[model samples]
Target: MPQTSKIFYQLKPLLQYVPSIEPPEKRVPLQDKLFWTLGCLLVFLVASQTGLYGIRIGDKTPDPWYWFRAVLASNRGTLMELGISPVVTSSLVMQLLIGSRLLHVDYSNKEDSALYTSAQKLCAIVITVGEALAYVVSGKMF
Candidate 1:
């Protein structure tokens, strides 16, 4: 086995007993823009769909609001500057670490399982809250 596959093989059985974590079921789309619009709203919390498209490209004119609006539209760019991006980037790093046995969890032990569960919850919370704050404070939504 390749080193990566071998590492995953060792951890595979442990993950089986770690308990499945599922996101809450969301409302099914009804072939209408309503749900899609709502979903976008949840993500952006913006005024309207049209308003979102207007801010896409940075304005050329020397308007003060142009920079402000661009910063809002480029949410990831703004978040990158605010030091929140690493928390997100580190989550991916942690996944690679877990897969590579750099952060091994001995799932055979109940305590270890609980620790893994808590870590997962903590990661989820941080990502969710961080994204929400980024959307709201950066004015990216609307």
Candidate 2:
């Protein structure tokens, strides 16, 4: 079977649970489905191309020399210029910390409007500083 049909078959159980008047398979027209799929793929390809261009050449179209120079001059960029390994490690560390509740804040029994606002500010500050330092230390800030 085709990959798409296999996926539809896999979702058969969930589709059966829905109390719809028409069956799910026949609900959408073949033309509409094909158009939607192709439209999404075309958009994705365009977006990916633009993003890749931006990364490789930055904003300037003439040359990528300036981008490399800028990366070397900045500390954060220097880390990224080195490699992608540090960035991934730092992201993993932060994810683990948040998941383990090491960065959890208590808002229980505190409904004051001003207090909530202050808490939000505090959380933003912590997250910003934490992420920045994480990148710097892990050698991937750029």
TM-score of every model versus the real structure: 0.35, 0.25
Highest-scoring model, TM-score: 1
What is the lDDT for 22 in model 2? 32
lDDT of 1 by residue, 1-142 (tens): 3343344445555545545546548865577558778786666533322233335424344543445444434332232222334345446765777887767766786656555555554555567578668866988543
Global lDDT of model 1: 0.52
Q: Against the hidden true structure, what lDDT does model 2 obtain?
A: 0.43
Q: Give the residue spans of candidate 2 off by over 4 A.
A: 1-111
Clashing pairs in 2: none
Tens digit per residue, CA lDDT, model 2, 1-142: 3232233344454444433333376578899989999997776445434432124424334533446535433212222232223334445654464477554323353323223233334444455566557746985222
Error of 1 at 69 (Å): 23
